[model samples]
Target: MTAVAHTSFVIERDFLASPARVFRGWSELALKQRWTDCHSDLAGRTHTLDFRPGGSETVTMRFPQGGTCVVRFHYFDIVPDRRIVYGYAMELDGRAGSVSLVTVEFAPTPAGTRMVFTEQAALLEEGQDLAERIEGTREGFDRLARELEPAPARP
Candidate 1:
């Protein structure tokens, strides 16, 4: 049986803002925090993003039960207003665990930008299934969609 698998999702959002503005939200720290970090339900979690090739990002999710998980990503490619490619790994208190590849593409639309995200993950340990992981990822993207809804008009 194959231990590696790929999962893909396409998300379209109508932004009152232009594609350039939306793309900036993906690459800038302050803009990313507005949509992503502020919307996270996990308490006390912190996110650090470095937007550049060979840069890295780390998100630490702290649990009320005194446990924490850190997600780390190493940026491989970054194109302004277009795409981002990275390698990701999850760690339990700094111990490396599962690894994956992620690609995010942004295309200009009549209204805004259509974003497509794809991930290829490998289960390095026994008893982990790709289907389960992919389903979780799909749910995550859905949550992102909710978080990124367009704002009301500014008077």
Candidate 2:
């Protein structure tokens, strides 16, 4: 029998930008591509986003070694520059792998914006575990930090 495990985790980060700017990084398509895995070195990869309540986002990438992985996100609630709640599922080569509900809250700080991310997930026996997911998420956020950096003014 296949086993299903449940887990939840939270990560918080502060950005040196306004809450609106930070929120735009997630809501804007071009900006999101800079931080997310939309630029992976995969063949036949595609990413589409519709950032609104009840909207959906999908990303598919085929690994060079073998197999394809797909992630689909369905937005449940969105409060511009404040909060977002979404549910997502992962599939490996057309087989169901895992499902998760995620919540992100943005708050204004004296210096900039603070974001709190919470994810509750169910892992299938054949899928990755919570620790791996956490690590990947941390790496993604690290990339986001770089993406959020301001560009230098042209001479």
Per-residue alpha-carbon lDDT of candidate 2 for residues 90-123, written as tens digits (9 for 90 to 100): 9998988899999999999998899999999988
Clash numbers, per candidate = 0, 0
Tens-place lDDT digits, model 1, residues 1-155: 44543344344444444556666766777656555553255657788988899999888888766667888889999988788899989876665557888887878878666777777766555566666766665555454555456766999
Every model's TM-score = 0.73, 0.93
**Residue 132 error, candidate 2, Å:** 1.6
Model 2, runs deviating above 4 Å: 153-155
lDDT of 2 at 155: 100
